[model samples]
Target: MMTIVVSVLFARSTRSTFPSDGSTSSLITHYLAGAAIASGVIVTPPAVLALTTYVLAPSLRHLFERLLLYPLFGAAALVFLFLAVTTWKPGPGTPTSNMDTAASLVNAAAASALATSGIIVTTTGILASNFWLTLYFDARRCHPYDHIVLFLLGTAAHIRRERHRWHDDNQVTIWRASLEVVAVQVERDAPLSGRTGLAEGSAYMELRQEARRIAAVIRSHKRDLAEAYSAHDVDAVVASLVVGLRAFCVGDRTALLAHAPAEVAPRVGRFARTALRLIPATVLIVAGILLPLVPSIAHSELASNLRWYLIVMGTITFITTREDLATKIGEAVAKVLLK
Candidate 1:
């Protein structure tokens, strides 16, 4: 199919019937874009090769055993390292002029975005390759389909990764679900936690109250709290109220981990939503690069847009989900009811 398309395009390019002005540039752009799409979507070499490697890796284990496999693994690792070093593009020859500076900035931004996409692609490939590698070693057989599927999954995963990172190219946000630290605080209340069932039940309620208080602080001053937690000073602030965290986790059933806030669940869920948005955006940008929808637009521009989109999505995902309360309820259910 790719050959047919290329042949048809090249055939058209040769005909005198097409206009001779900027039409040639447009045609060239289309041909190149289409070729890229053809390779990426259909005839991608890495995907095919990786698939083959995955299929055979298992058989190697059976034939050579672990002792003989070590050198082959090392050699393969070295080759991968070489490929990485070969592809590593150093920064542009220090942009001297204003136009050079501008172009350099654009390129820098583009490279970062593409690299992120590449990482994601690599991650997925790594996951798929590792899975198939395990399967091959486990089965002690070579299957072309298994290898091919690995390649497909890996390549697509790579592109998807790049596309994801591209969409989140700008204004990186540093945020966390902030649940783990909160769990520590909950643990601190453990000494008095055991008192809840007896006449001193008010102290147990106080621990729950403390949870609310900490939760409120998180909601009102997230940036400040985040900064504090980042510095590892969060535990210090509530040191007075929190008993030994270990006490709760050990003998105390009232420990935070066993009964941590159900609210962290929504935050986890939000991150999932952000990932959901990332998938289609990547597909769109890659598709656009291949299609060449407008003659004026460059494939690089489409790539650039993808980076910006990712940045926006990441920023939004990080911010909007901050101090999310829905997770608290869900966490409560999972810990108490589900358990």
Candidate 2:
């Protein structure tokens, strides 16, 4: 029953053309359904690849740890072989009754082998590639996805102030650590969380409380915080100086900024900075949403391809920009849910 329901949902989801003639509520429903479907499609491969690696890692740890791309290449070879077998067709021929019967049995066996091999090889290749890339990035201690995390969890307020600070030496680390610290505070004070909107009340209050906490921490280690913030790169411990400090309140912001140079502060307001960060993602989203509406492109394979391309590009833009899109979403949601 559940499987049938899910299948129906996915089937309906794929047919969505984002019709422009719909009522407002209908349009919203369609958009949300389409977005949900897209998110599932986008996330499924990575989830499967991760699970495959985890299940195989214990037995094949050495192979992945050392061989890396060699395993991926071997997997690719298997995939090519599977494809070759599946596509190979019997040549034009005439045969007796005995030959026909024998050929049918042979073909059945071949079909079974192809089906089994295709699944195994495809999954192996996907997991091998994912694991190799993960190891490659891990060795360098730099994960680009961290930028996405920063954007998702960051408030528009913080992104507005620290937009320029992103990707700088120790900047990602600083923000990540700060978020962890704030998360700890939120968790500890879970009972005290506001009854109103999650962000407007809870997150806002937490940011203020965090500001005071950071101010105290800085007072005792002013020189240390200053030196780390001003340096090109900071170690793990110092890197977590909480970038949120500067955005929470004027006093804390001033104290934290005192150590850094005057030129480091952003010149624009929060809304302007947030808008700047959103441009690429917004453009891609707009293009994706509107491309299929063109009469010339309607129902064509090119339209489908371009829409997927735009969707992927837009998603990448959102990821690369550190989730400015999500911040906007949170802000919008908070407004509706405000007490």
Candidate 3:
């Protein structure tokens, strides 16, 4: 039941062209039903249930595209299940603490093996089912090759170690530590629990009161609190926030310059500087876009020569502009201030 639910959910969430046309949902439902029926039929069970399901599903009789897709979807579900199991971590109270690292390594290796096998099985099942030729050109509508490339990319990413940072801790430890430090003050101000059966409600009231007291204390020591937070830590936090805001405000000249609309001359100067720097690459890109319209010009020997010329000019422009921009920016800043 868990397997079926997870497979259905994954199939639904995946990006497929058929989903927009409402065929993917039907295909997945029928495929899983077929797999379940086949599982009951074979006394010993086949080596690949996905292959069996693809072969047995009568709904897939006329739908050659579904015949190819169902097996791939099944294989993907198996891979996702394997990954989930392998990466799952036990709670803090769970046993096997000493072997946790070793166990993780083993699980990762096994999951990689399973993923590779799943891909192989999917490919083999498609070929053995004799749907490859039918799917080759006809399946272009579904972009199967793009999906395969994406799957390979996902698998590659999964095999790599995940990157984590201290900032990713969600600040839980910091909150816990703060509570612990103020526990004595909290107890002095309010009872930890009420008498009789009113413990839950009383505890909630005490927590609210304690939070108010903590907030007041923080407000009173705002200056000291500011000083206590190191310059580096404050800068790091500010920098992180600025990075996100900067990305959002990118290309918004008014937000970036913070000057009045009357400053048209400086804006024009900036534009001229930028356009001069980008001329080589911009010309090449424009030529590439326009060349196809004129067959005579496109086929001329000059056209072939321009490709190498563009490359050389682009390289020189990049190097010179990179070096020139810093000097030009300084001069612009001086001119603005002196004005």
Best by lDDT: 2
- Models ranked on TM-score: 2, 1, 3
Q: Give each model's clash number.
A: 25, 1, 0
- Which tens-of-lDDT digit does each residue in 262-322 have in candidate 2? 2221124333444565687789878978988899887775676667666666666666555
Which tens-of-lDDT digit does each residue in 192-257 have in candidate 3? 232323457766664445434432332222232234344344344333324323422342323322
Model 2 global lDDT (CA atoms, 0 to 1)? 0.45
Among all windows of 10 consecutive residues in model 1, the one with the lowest summed lDDT is 169-178
Whole-model Cα lDDT of every candidate shown, in order: 0.38, 0.45, 0.40
Question: lDDT tens digits, residues 67-156, model 1?
Answer: 223333333333333323332322566444444333333333333333333333444445556766896685456431233223323333
Q: Which 10 consecutive residues of model 2 have the lowest summed lDDT?
A: 260-269
- The full ranking of all candidates by lDDT, starting with the best, is 2, 3, 1
What are the C-alpha RMSDs, in order, of all predicted structures? 23.0, 20.3, 27.8
| Distance from true location, Cα of 178 in model 2, Å | 7.4
Runs in model 3 lying further than 4 Å from the true structure: 1-69, 72-74, 77-86, 105-118, 121-132, 135-339
Looking at model 2, the pairs that clash are 151-322
